[model samples]
Target: MQIIQSLSEISGRYRALFVDLWGCVHDGVHPFPGAVEALKAYRATGGKVVLVTNSPRPRDGVAEQIAGIGVPADAYDAIATSGDSARLAMYQGAVGTRVWHMGYADESDDGFFTPPAILDDPLAIERVPLERAEGIVCTGPADPYADPSEMRPQFLAAKTRGLKLLCANPDIVVDRGGRREWCAGAYAQLYTEMGGESLYFGKPHPPIYDLARRRLAAIADVGDASILAIGDGPQTDAAGAMGEDLDLLFISGGLGAEETGTAIGGSPDPARLERYLAETGVAPTYVIGTLR
Candidate 1:
């Protein structure tokens, strides 16, 4: 697939843009080339852009991280993250309600633009006893899932509690420096397999996009179909766009290099690709190797 060459083509078609962070804009370490300019050009042509990500950080925290990495703060209008979404979902309850942060949250986790109870110590969650817990919000560091054996403890904990598991990042795993790393979703799947109930609040889950649209509506009265969702992962990004009935710019550049046997995601059979797309019940409006 060809890279999206210029912003002009994307200008008229999309009213507002919901762009993914992490793999699409940065590699967890640095920003991609021309990513900022791409958003600037999109906004220059009268489009409103919102950075939609599954990052476990809040909006301001996300903006700060992106800015530190070279993306211009003015390039996009705002951000919406799964962390904030999870927090929102958590406190839709009575005041002073107890919640177990079944995950890790740091100083950066504060000032989320929405505040909720945060318990950083995973052991506290394990030792605190489950009866006092109202709900379990799982978001923590997952690294080097080289062997499933390494992922055992935490996986077993959530399963043992079987409390309402809130998966902040919907992705099962992601690549870090060419090494595959797990995320909240891996345990989430295990939790489900072990008959533990859970709720995923990010990509491939339509409610996130729904929340994003409602947020965007404050700027412009746009419909869902007019919102373009862009991302690098075909499964999460493309599939999520499909779930929301939005157009997709399936970026082929990033982690998939191995899936394609040429670029991102590595080598995979064409039939498998077709099946992946078919299962979503929504198709991309365009496919590109990069956002350009």
Candidate 2:
């Protein structure tokens, strides 16, 4: 893989970018100034940026959250979230009408249940007890910091009942600032391992990419050949970009910093980076310590 110092080295080659938000742009609590400037500069060159995130929040909700975190409105053109894609499946009855909700209980997660305005007719989805539900809708664990194995009993019971799980965010974990936390994909992986079915809508899976392409198309007529995918997650972003046959710019300073020996505001150690890429089995077109 080519290790590059800045996005400007190859920015002119792509008409659009499918950028991951959590690690590449912000660290959940704050925005990365260099990353923000990179995107803004890219936009100034007439490039469209589609923030394709595996966040379990709708497009507008993500926009609001990012804006609150200091990422300005001009940094991106549009957003396509895993939540919106999974919500479309849920409202289309991927999980039966009566489903059990698994995630944060607070209002911060309420946007996931909101029906999409684009849908002409969405099913009347109901949040019911797991015992009475036909399927499960998992945005994430009620407690992200807790071990995923803690849900084995519930997953086993759901499996016995033949309930399918619709995983909104197919990310195993995310680094919120400096703390690592489990995500919906961890729970979904556990459920599937226990012989339960899990439907994923985010990265490495085709659904979210399709949704992101649609969002990108709404702004520009860019094809996969002219689009670049950027993210920190090796499996999610790198694998997804490879699956979609798009070039990838892997940000090593985020999730894989420790493994790749990437220090903050610095590039990764070449030997460690090669080993990390070999182990992950993903080949990114370009690598950078951060988005800039």
Number of the top lDDT candidate:
2
Residues 1-292, candidate 2: write the lDDT tens digits. 8999999999999999999999999999998769999999999999999999998889888888899989999999999899999999999999899999998645466478888888899999999999999999999888888999999998889999999999999999998888999999999999999999999999989999999999888888998999999999988999999999999999999899999999999999999999999999879999999998
CA displacement after TM-score superposition, residue 25 of candidate 1 (Å) = 1.1
TM-score of each: 0.80, 0.98
- How many backbone clashes does every candidate have? 14, 0
At residue 66, give the lDDT of candidate 1. 82
- Against the correct fold, how does model 2 do in TM-score? 0.98
Q: What lDDT is obtained when candidate 2 is compared to the true structure?
A: 0.92
How good is model 1 by TM-score? 0.80
Compose the digit string of candidate 1's lDDT tens values, residues 1-292: 2235444576588899999887777776667666777888888888889888887677777888888878888788878788777666655531114455544433334543254544332121222434556555667543335443454565466557656777777777776555677777776677677676778878878767776887798789888768888886666777888777788876655555445333432323445444544654436776555555
- Shift in Å, residue 143, candidate 1: 4.3
Q: Candidate 2 regions off by >4 Å?
A: none
